[model samples]
Target: MTPPHATPVGPDLPMPFTHAGVDQLVSIWLAQLDVIRDLAEELTAEQWAAASPCPGWSAGDVVAHVLALESELHGAPLTDHEPDWAALPHITSDFGRLTERAVDWYRTKGQDVVVAELIEITAWRRDDLAHAWNADSDPNEVVTGPLGLELPRERLIRTRILDTWVHEQDIRTAIGIPGGLRSDAAWVCAGQFAFGLPYVWGKKAAAPIGATLDLTVTGPGVSFERLVQINENGRAEFIERTATPATVSLTLDWPTYAAASAGRLNSDSTGALVANSCRGDDQLAARLMPALAVTP
Candidate 1:
């Protein structure tokens, strides 16, 4: 259960979107968009069926999820006029139809039309989110999910930012986009991801008191927490952080960290992690190796 306004990670301080932050967010947004746009350039019936990072989800399912979320944020389907209960099957069936129609439409139309359709959806998503978030609302409004938490407006916006960022990666990887993420979106898009640390780590502390961990990335953009990740078998992990009093610290370049979270590193170079501030780099890296299979 998610609180209507509950912050994703936890209640960390909110920072105003600086000029640099805004630029990074846009870059991330557009870069992901570019990948999807580029892929739409030449998707065959089979490519659309390719598997994504997420289990049981293909490129098509990922796109459907995006459309569902964006539509939910500001459309009648998720309207305030609903009965106080989630229309579970109804929602799934409805969106299922949407996805089927979209795929059929993709198969039916010219490449130009497909691009136009995606552009329209993205434009609408941007407009709706901007309108809802940019407005003045009580930060403590009852917008939380069933989770007993309430996040401010900025925090909610961060989720949308993340959805776009991560899902784009889903699409990119499916199409075999080379290299790491081209934009500084990781920095810009991580507020919500960072907000989830407490929830992800829970009350568990992996590091000793006053331990030092440094997280650095070679990217040109604003700074936010880098994306947080946990390993597949649930032992290894990656987190965005610097040396400080905390548990489990690791360091990697921003894009590499992001790509590392995806699966492997770009330069075949592994990152360093200090576990209990005791394990050697190789061992620490060994610990964090399996989180790449995480689904969004």
Candidate 2:
């Protein structure tokens, strides 16, 4: 869901325009994958083993997860293995176990092997995706995406771009090499995640009808201000302007906003609620904070 007014600002940053074709989206996804591959190639063994922001996933594990998904998308068979559920308390859902099977398989291999496998798999995926999709392909054609979700091709590719970029940030955070925040992929991810604010407010937070929320994201990569209003039908939608003051307002930096939107800010190990500033309805803001994470 790309927000109507969310515009990514920076030189050469590609905005996820509503009319963007599959080719443009694929280009963004490929760029994000290149960033991850380059970063992985430079990682030290210690950094590879470092714990990422994803609970129970090391930096290498995160890479393996990405490799696992792309490999599946490229027609590679799933690894026939089941992880020890009791030992993996962080894997609380069926999808977690499904993804963990492949990640855990790679965990037994050495760092060099993991990196090499990622490089190989992603290379294959790049070629496969290029052949599979083109600018004229139907963007609305439903196709299977990660976790077996059926989505339009354009949306699936956009989701891939978002996931890859987020994992890249996870790796960077783990290794203390924070960067790529201003990349083309970062702007895409910013808009993609920010698009879920209405869902976060209406469905997750259950804000009362007619209530309005103002969300301001300060970004070096992509900056935007969103005004979400719950309508008479109990649905939230962005409004251009309103006469009444917002019921609540929250401001966050780009990185912090990304982390929170991806549910990383809820991590017991690295969560930082202090990174955000809230005003107006305190109770409503508190409710909205936990519900901010739109992704599972």
Off by over 4 Å in 1: 1-42, 76-120, 135-151, 179-184, 190-205, 219-249, 259-296
Give per-residue CA lDDT, model 2, range 1-296, as digits (tens). Answer: 32333453421232355456788888889878888888889999899999998999999999988888888888788788877778999988877788889999988887899789878877887898788898888999999987667988888988898899999999999999888877767777777876787888999888999989887777756576778899999999877655778899887888888888888875442223523488788778778887888666
Which pairs, if any, clash in model 2? none
lDDT value, candidate 1, whole model: 0.44
**Alpha carbon lDDT at 19, candidate 2:** 58
The alpha-carbon root-mean-square deviation between model 2 and the true structure, to one decimal in Å, is 3.9
Q: What TM-score fits each model?
A: 0.53, 0.91
Please give, for residues 1-296, the per-residue lDDT of candidate 1 as tens digits.
11122222221234223223333343345455555555654666566667776544567656655554544544524322222124323234543444344333343444455456566666775565455543344434556421123565444444445556677777667767643343434444543433334333322333222332333334323233333333344432444443433333454444444544544332234423323222324433344433331223
Best model number under TM-score: 2
C-alpha lDDT values of all predictions: 0.44, 0.80
